[model samples]
Target: RITESQNGWCWQGPVEVVWSNPPAQAGSPRVPAVGLHSTTALLQVTVEDFEVVCKGLYRALRIREKYMQQSLQRFPRTPSQYLRAIEGEVWRASDTGPGTFKHLEGFPLCLAEDLGYHVQMKDGVVYIYGDKAAADRNEPKDLPYPSLERFMDDMNFLLALIAQGPVKTYAHRRLKFLSSKFQVHEMLNEMEEIKELKNNPHRDFYNCRKVDTHIHAAACMNQKHLLRFIKKSYCLDADRVVYDAKGKQLTLKQLFQQLNLHPYDLTVDSLDVHAGRQTFQRFDKFNDKYNPVGASELRDLYLKTENAIGGEYFATIIKEVGSDLEDAKYQHAEPRLSIYGRSAEEWPKLASWFSEHRVYSSNMKWMIQVPRIYDVFRSKNFLPHFGKMLENIFVPVFEATVNPRAHKELSVFLRHITGFDSVDDESKHSGHMFSTKSPKPEQWTSEKNPSYTYYVYYMYANILVLNNLRRSGTLLATQTLLGRKRSPVLQYLYFLAQIPIAMSPLSNNSLFLEYAKNPLPDFHQKGLMVSLSTDDPMQFHYTKVQCELMPSCCPSLGLGLRGPRFSGKPADAGPPLGQPLEQRGLCRQKPLAANTACGCRSR
Candidate 1:
């Protein structure tokens, strides 16, 4: 049916899109994207390539800070951690230790300038000047920001010409994209990422709504008006053209930027019960009784307060999701499934709802994604706590769950990022140090004998079920859709964690990264099935595809899809899990699914 097509820049070759998430964003543009509709087409774009680009950009920016800082005394311990003396206030590197190097982060710009020359940016042009300048401008062999300029210039050059593939005129709507290769497309670079197209792709895929799987169902449009919002969100006009309420005027991409400009702020403002005393005005679903809104469920509070009146635009979204709120279904009062109240306390009820609805039990080629450890709604104070808890607590639990070698690497990580000295064998530079390796979960919290937080326990129980499902031959990444038999040792346990620096801000400084550092690509390599996701669309102002972009110019994270396990042997006839890790497909190279369901969402 020609579900989606690539225009702007074209390569006559069959263009493919591997949906990281099917319904990536609600009707975003005049053109259709992932979550605009619940379509069967799915594509998986690895985004590792873009991650490489982000790392490089982050490092380059780091070096620029060092050059501006000009602090030679405080030599950067590593290439990424810069120490510039001449700066007003130098920013710290997003990461540290040897791992940053592996990601292709380069030496600091100041040190790089020390290599040969020092160049400065005056107005818009780059030239050698000041003390570093030579009489002939050629005297200073080294440039101040050579390393930064060289790579970025090359990246910009490549990105410019690449998206505009040998300009073959294509038709869309009525007018042709014949002159589509103009500067606007070049500026937006909005063409389909041709380099990411997968061959022999999975044509039939799922597109569940993003951020809906989390405990914060209200963080979205809320249950009181959910079906109404859903109708507007996925509503199609007479031309089958998708428009969110505001989307009628602005494209989906523009809508996302607008959301980003004013993301939802999750705070004590959310725990506010006294914001208003009017009972009826309060959402009917919000109970002053059981499961009243609190810090854990701040999205609800944010919606009720900051987003109380969404103006004409929001009303339009409600109208669209309900198919105009006056459609036959609305008029008849038809009852659709109530997908709401996904709080921690409501897991049992939520699970039952999914089961009763045959959400996952049907072997329906679905992905059940749980949210990551990020906040439900975007907030200034959200990430620090989440990162602290994850590094300090979950790392140990995850270490125990995986095999020995993987466990050892996690231990190394603990040594480097933490401060506690090892009890048995001392190690250098640990992350959230505890005296002993794999200490009891009790060691993390002040409460005696309590192993982990309530959420961790919840996840552990769920992971046990997921692992069991994998062992019992029910789960096997994307292949499960084909109904193929899977091996016992192999697991389909997947996670969605987003990182930054992979691409630029929509304009200049769109996103702030520093204390919010998380680079978990290494985990993805070990069959963890970890890919990035956009958790809160309204908060993050991103479409799934926009969040997944890899700046065309960054270094490439080795692009290898998860290949097959069992080699030509039968699934049940495979080697046992006890074999050396290398022999098994624990680290296989096959593609994973992006069209599945997961809980918890992040920006």
Candidate 2:
């Protein structure tokens, strides 16, 4: 016989065989038994095979029992428990493999349903569809687990329960924990749910803090729609009084004051209403001042009014009247002229008016009046109201005509009015006042005289003034003293006239030509030379013709022609050729003989 073990290996009965002669054919031949074996050996072999088969079967049975125990353990102990656990699993596992519910198969359906779980049917298998069970199953789902929409719905429902108060303390704790773990949008969704369940019986049990939570969510999301909704419906004046977990309230109004949401001005209004006593008062005062006055006031008082008392009637009233009541105040006064040599009493009455109007005035007006007033003073020689007017009008005008020609004319006019000598006249005579005898022509060539220094300085000053005039375009339409467009020759003569004859010898013809062609009036010549003689030899070494001629050919000599002269006489009365040796007390007179031709008479 053969037997098979669970392992599938076969075992057969042991048998022995031996060789034998036929008994009928050979009576005389010795015969051996056809078969013989030791019974013990055979029995031992059979027992060994049976033992091996039995051991294999026993091992198989042990394995089967282990699997059975594992399967039974998976069965739900209670219907409710199973329903709740499996329902959730089913939903979660619809798109997943059955292996997903390997651990959840026996959970009671009643428990699963009570816990808000449901079964998802797919491919002839029911799957547990809940977040907790699915997580435990550790299996892939056929569809995404916990859809966003479904999650939101759940949150909304939970929030609604919370808002209805009498919330389970444990559930509320769990929700708070979830809130910390979840996103802001999720929290917002929960808040929306709470708002919806306004009439819930258990509302008192829920710690909604809906307004604060919604505001925080809105701030975090910064979503326009959500913010709009919160601002419109949820936020109250009291809600704006936000306090931190530590009990310190933040200054919400100040924080949001700069954010421009003018179209939603109502939000600001709401905030003001809810603001605490101090903040409410402050906001109210601000509002009252800014509120529009009647349209008639705007039309009647402010339009097209030049230099009006205030910005507008409303603005003026606010400045004058409202300022006294409000915390901030403004007052304006006219400029005073203490620096202009005026008595304080002479200041304008307008100063008081300006203060009354609370109009902001500047010193620019005073500056504009100065030049005109100075002109009047010059013409009149004396004004009884001079000191008073000066005191009243002390404004400084920074903006003068930048045109150089205009500036020069202004300066000249100022000098005329003040009876102050022109700068040119002072510079010319500065050298001659210290000298005694006229300098020799040769001595005049030396670079050591005050006259030469004065000449050079004056010429440089003129050039600078002319260059400035040119740049300012004030020179464009300049005319001669005779009131005709100045000829190039006269212009050149005028430029040369500014330089002492001694100095001209050092200037180049090109420079002369440039000056001649320049459109600027010869202001230096016109203003400086009216009384000063041009042909003074002691001051200027050369004759006028020589001075003019030298620049044409002898530019090098011109470079130092204005060098100092060494004379002892006033420049204007010096001899044409400078001092003679006789004038210096170096030679004695010689008597003329009767026969000698007298040089003086001969001439």
**lDDT of each prediction vs. the true structure?**
0.24, 0.23
For candidate 1, give the lDDT: 0.24
Worst 10 residues of 1 by lDDT: 418-427
* Each prediction's RMSD to truth: 25.9, 57.3
How do the residues 112-197 of candidate 1 rate in per-residue lDDT, one tens digit apiece? Answer: 01112233323112333234546346453222322323433443433342232221111110011111222233345334432232
Stretches of candidate 2 exceeding 4 Å from the true structure: 1-348, 360-371, 377-382, 385-603
TM-scores for all candidates?
Answer: 0.24, 0.12
TM-score of 2: 0.12
Q: Which candidate is the best by TM-score?
A: 1
